[model samples]
Target chain A: MSEPLLSVRNLTMRFGGLTAVDDVSFDADQGAITAVIGPNGAGKTTLFNCLTGFYRPSSGALHLQAAGHVHRLERMQGHRIARRARVARTFQNIRLFPGMTALENLLIAQHNDLMRASGFTFLGIFGWPGYRRAEAAAVEKARYWLARMGMEERGDDLAGQLPYGAQRRLEIARAMCTEPVLLCLDEPAAGLNPRESAELNQILLLIRREHGCGILLIEHDMSVVMGISDRVVVLEYGRKIAEGTPAEVSRDPNVIRAYLGEEESAA
Target chain B: MTVPAMLRDAGLAALVALALALPVVGIRTVDTGAVLGLDYRFGWVAIAVGIVFGGRLTALLLYDRLPRGPRRIRTKGLAGRSRTLVRYAAVAFIVFAAALPQLPFSDRYVVDTATQVLIYVMLGWGLNVVVGLAGLLDLGYVAFYAVGAYSYALLAKNFGLSFWECLPLAGAFAAFFGILLGFPVLRLRGDYLAIVTLGFGEMIRILLINWTTLTGGPNGLTSIPRPDFFGLAFTRSPAAGETAFHEFFGLAFSTQHRITFLYYLILILALVTGWAVERMRRLPVGRAWEALREDEIACQSLGINRTTTKLTAFAIGASFGGFAGSFFATRQGFISPESFTFIESATILAIVVLGGMGSQVGVVLAATVLVLLPEVFRDLAHYRMMVFGLAMVLIMVWRPTGFVTQRTPTVRLSDFTPDPGAAR
Candidate 1:
């Protein structure tokens, strides 16, 4: 088989004397959904942060293979990770530019492409032909994504004014506009209702099947983690306990104990 | 509320005013030729209390009658109607402004005051870019104005450069200073950024004062050359073979000719500034600025380099300020550090805030109100500033956001319809 899309080796992140993500490593394959499951404070977010260049790992390497080149994400800046490594992420808490329109939020994700076409804004200021063409293409892409999210009618509305569930979906659509090789979503299902979660499942499946990009999702919702994820990596207190297909991981004895707590010997 | 509540509120305000005015205004010291004596002015105090009571009661009644609760969502029809209204108002204002100098009643004083108003309008637009659009609180904007003025003065005095030649140079110099200021305060935001910019303004003023050889200390540079109409001097007599403006135009030499010329020069500059800024708002860089203002972290997440985006705003905003400064130097034929002070920056910032952040027409209206309020109250003598402050307070109370707070989207979907095949 071809090499995995992302390779995280001995990733360790610490704060002072405490190790938040302790030597945890995993590979997320291309065109597949990889769900990272853990209990509270299992260093799930810390690990995501380390992967996205939000935090410097205490020790280890994060290698992303794209365009026939290996990019070390650990050394890059937060923006560089998104720009160069093509790794896009959505925050656990929605971070859309609240005042901007839904379409503009998605357009901003296409900033690098537009910026290059605009000649870093000097040419764009004159509304040059090249810049105008790029902008039209950008608007078209934004329109497509807004349509994909079933939000074509609400593209002009401000992101903040959208209902909570729509805001989550808009955030995902915005990340997709960047055309990332690897998309990291932190609890994309956190506040979603069952219907919305079910809708979100379909969207994720569609993205994997159509876009063929790697997805790294961190979710507490068991239905979402087990329902659609091709692979599940369970972490208990920053240590990986099990890694396998959803059925195998669900059946693992250690995974069940870590989630339910030692089987209660008295019971 | 109810009439009784309004009366009670007004009564409480009146009582507070009376309590405060009794010590400060009701009684005063008088010196006779032989002795100092106390004089009672209870009648004036009563009059003041009565006025306050009546004004507050009226204000409360007016506010009570205004629409309350959630505002109705603006429909496309309503938005289009408002846009048309604004367009009509803008056209009317431009016509009035363009005709002011040529109007039969326009005297030198009238032209000069109008010119002053235009200068503030230009500065207001420039500051609007930084404070309103970029969401960077800059209390040191006048430093760029000062840089532009000094650069023009020094360059013209030392290098013999003409006003037209020095204008862009001055703007570039101010923009350079803007970038210099931009670098240090990059990590800072909001109030901290404001304080640093305030210090940066004072630093420039202090530097001008101490840099005796360069800036001429507190005495300032004088005899700066007046701008000409493309090699034609505005003076009555031509210098050697050079042509005078009146001679070239075959008209009588009047000092009003130069005044009108300067007036039109600034009018053109101000118009160009407004036009360019409006266009820039539609550009990607401008969108980035508004996005940065909305959320910096979101911008970083989207792969936007924060440093360049911010520095571009500062540079562009400062360039306009610099252009205004050079024009000011040419018009006055004299410039000093005294002209560019913290008060100037405050006044410019006030125009931006009062106009409605990021609204071009709003800046024009706010500048007119702020500049005219003081001139209109000149007869108030020592109470002029008090009247001006009161008017500002009234405006703020009436329209907390601004006189015009509508935010038209930079780009609308209707501007470009998507193809049927585009959707995946």
Candidate 2:
């Protein structure tokens, strides 16, 4: 079988004395959705942060294999992780450029590509033909994402003015604009209603099947975790207790106890 | 909330004002012909207390009448209409400025004051790139101006270069200094960044004062060559090989001709600066700067390099400040550290802020008001500042954000074709 898209070995992150993510390990494959499930403060975000280069891990090896290249994700910076590693993420809370338009938010995700085409903006300032063509292509891509998110008409509206669900979708569309090999989503359905969550599941499935990018998701909504995710990695107190197909992990006795605690363990 | 509550509030305020005035404005030392005597001006105190009480009561009543909640939508519509009105006003102002020197009432004093206003407008636009679009609060903006002026002075004196030759060089030097400051302050944000920039501005001034050999110390460098009309000197008598401007044009030599030329030069420079800044707003770098301003973490996730993006803003903004500074040196034919001070920085910042942070047209309007307010109130002597302060307070109370706070998007949906075929 082809190697998994991403492999994490012994990943641990600590804040002074508190180990947020402790010896967590998982394999997420290309064209598959892997959901990391945990109770609050089970280090789900900490793991995502480590993967996206927001925090330097205490000890870990993160290797992303894409397009015949092996990228050591642990060695890169926050922006380099997105740029060179082709890894993009949406925050737990939406972090769109509120003052900019939805179209601009997508365009910014394509910064590296546009920056090169603009000759680092020297050619762009003078509106060189090549830069103009590149910019038009970029705007086209932004429009495409807007249309896919059912927001094509609202392209010019400021991102902050968008409705709550639209903002969440816009954030995902912005991440997709980077064309990342792996998309990390932190609680995309946190504020979403059931209908929106269902829609979000379809979008995730479409991204996985069409784009063929590995998806690393951290979610608490069991419907989303069980209905769509092909693989499940259960983390308990910053430690991975089970990793398998969704059906296999859901039935695991250890997983159940970790999620619902042992009968008398607390008492 | 009620009439009685407001009356009580006003009464309490009046009592406090009386207590404060009793030790200050209520008493004065009078020269009683033979000896100085304390004059208890009880009537003045009563008048002051009465004014405060009436003023507070009136203000409270007006505040109660202000529209709230649902009426805010009308205010938004008003903002939209005002934006259009501002655009028209901007065009009219530009036309009036262009014809100022040619107007019947024009003279050296008028042209010079107008020139000073243009200089501040240019500087405000430059700093707007950093503070307005990029969200970097720069307080040391005057440092670049000083650098530009000093760079022009040193270059013209030492290398015998003309003003045109030194203009770009001065801008480049200021840009270099901007980067120098940028490197250390990249990690800072908001108020911390502002404090550092303030310190940086003062540092430049202090450095100029002590760097005697280069900047001629506090006395400053005098007799700096004025910019010529190309190679033609603005003089009655032509140098051996050089042509006098009047002679080249076959017109009479008048000092007024030079003054008009200087005015037009600055006007052209300022217009170009405005044009370039507008163009930049539509470009990728400009969008990146605005994006960085809105959310640094989001910018990082989008793969925009924070370092280069911020440095570019600093460099571009500083270059414009430098250009204005070079023009200033040529206009005055003098260079001094005193010309670039914290107050100058504050005034330029005030123009940007009062105009509206990201509004280009707002800067021009604000610059005119800020620069001309002092001149218009010159006869008021010490009271001029009080008048200025009152005007500022009134403006703030009226529109806390700015005179024009509406932001026009750099690009619109109509600007591009949204091709369905582009979707993967």
Candidate 3:
């Protein structure tokens, strides 16, 4: 009803001659959770990258009307996409600055704020009250995000030292610190135990309800996806075969044929 | 994040505080000026200057050294803090620097040595941008130095410009050449960049050596005017009333005034150098440089224009080198190709490396040691470089990563704050 917070129109991604993603389009409603599901190499991550400014689409338009402005995602670069579009993302394979502590990782995500804190001078770092205030605010924001992720006690620990599940959560926390309107998660539930997966579901639900944020996740874990996703957009070989409510998509022949186990398809 | 900044800050502060306090606090001055801040007549002066600089630098990084309370500086938050701190620190520096030169001191030579040290420190900071921050190992930083020197000499001789007048022109010309050198080697990196830069340095020197009509060939440029006070040179003049510099101060000018003036000049310059580099580290370009240093791919992924970042690193670095170069030429009232050599680059590189790649304090420490050690070893000048070479090897063997144990992350300080996100 509110013009779908973000709209992707005929998005296609090509790597030289190979087409990784072709003619994919979807509408992500404002403040709704949308799950993009596929097997390995379904171009889910590629699509996420395109949307987040890591890869500029070969052709298509991505528009976002959030916080009172229309932004063309295709027109932005990676950092700008993160900053201007307010699009924050977690990588499929975690990319926390290895040497940095878990908390430092979150702060880096808030880099745009540092630009404001500098006041464009070395002298400004000490003399400018604005810089000091901005610094304190950024620290406050980071603290809020870290605590929300249940990493308050382990903030001093290195990101690499965090357990697999904690690292996954850290990634999400890092992204949230950017204050994004849309949070893109790539296999956030991967490598997590059932308990962790359930915890992750709770976290996502909280993010959706509390922040009113939109989530676009790429997950192969059927239980987690079915358990949490409000809507499922099934991607088969980079093509969307079924898009509907989780139950409806699960019942669709194409989705069952491609994603369900062999016995289920046979039945 | 680089070693030089950290090492310079740490080493300089330690040396300065120790050197000055030791004599007064009864840390007996060992007669020989060869070991432990004891070399040369001005050995203690070198140490005093070293420590003050080091201490200031330490104060800047004090946040990093202190015990980081668990989770207070979260890894997630660290990235933000590291990047932002540089920006904030830079701003504070510029404003405070306005009142610096007026700070009074007793020994004049301490000030002079401090100035020379400051000049080198600036040069080291610039070279750190290329080799330390950008991950470009340039062995030809002196090329910019040569360019600045020649630019100043030729400008003054041809245009009748004053020392102050030639300063900016020297910087601009050096920056122009830095970019010119950068354009052709856009694809090169690491060792290749080093070789190209090495060649660039040699090329400048050779040109200066051969350009007889302009650079005066090997004989060197002479009659170069020294820096003046308004229109008055610091020379002894009957009209000035006082033979001793202190008389004007109502105390006595003595030999110390000359040292005092030169010391303050370079100190201010060094302070400016610190300020400029710190400021640049925060600008969009500065982040690009750090990103480039850490991971070129990520830097590109972030949409940082590498071409601009690399060129700016070069241009900025070269501009500082030029500043030092101009200062050097003016200090001696002479210019020659002999001073601009590959070895000079290597020595400065050693300062950057020994100090810690991107750490400003580290390099200052390295510079203080690298420059003053040899001068202090004036008795063994013949074996000075040999001793220096061995010391470098020893330090590398001991602390291969650098004298400073940790590097400042590219992220800012906010990450250290308790994060509500983590708690949830």
Residue B422 C-alpha lDDT in model 1:
58
For model 3, what share of native contacts is present? Answer: 0.15
Model 3: how far is A106 from its true place, Å?
3.7
Q: Judge candidate 1 at residue A138 and give its lDDT.
A: 85
Evaluate residue B181 in candidate 2 and report its C-alpha lDDT on the 0 to 100 scale. Answer: 93
What does DockQ come to for candidate 2?
Answer: 0.75
User: What RMSD does each model have against the real structure?
Assistant: 2.9, 2.9, 12.3
Which 10-residue window in model 2 chain B sums to the lowest lDDT? B71-80
lDDT of 2 by residue, B1-424 (tens): 8999999999999999899778766788889999999989888889989999999999999999987676443223543466578679768977998999999999999998899999999999999999999999999999999999889988998899988889899999999999999999999999999999999999999999999988999999999888788888998887798899999889988999889998999898999899889888878888899999999988888788999999999999999999999988888888889999899999999999999998898898899899889899999986588679778888888778887787777766678865667655
Q: Give the alpha carbon lDDT tens digit for every residue of A121-180 in model 2.
A: 778878889988888888888887787788889887889989999999999999999999
True contacts kept of 1: 0.56
Residue B340 miss distance in model 1 (angstroms): 1.5
Ranking by TM-score: 2, 1, 3
> How accurate locally, in lDDT, is each candidate?
0.90, 0.90, 0.75
Give stretches of model 1 more than 4 Å off.
Answer: B1-12, B15-43, B53-77, B420-424
What TM-score goes with each of the models? 0.93, 0.94, 0.73
- What RMSD value applies to candidate 2? 2.9
Worst 10 residues of 3 chain A by lDDT: A118-127
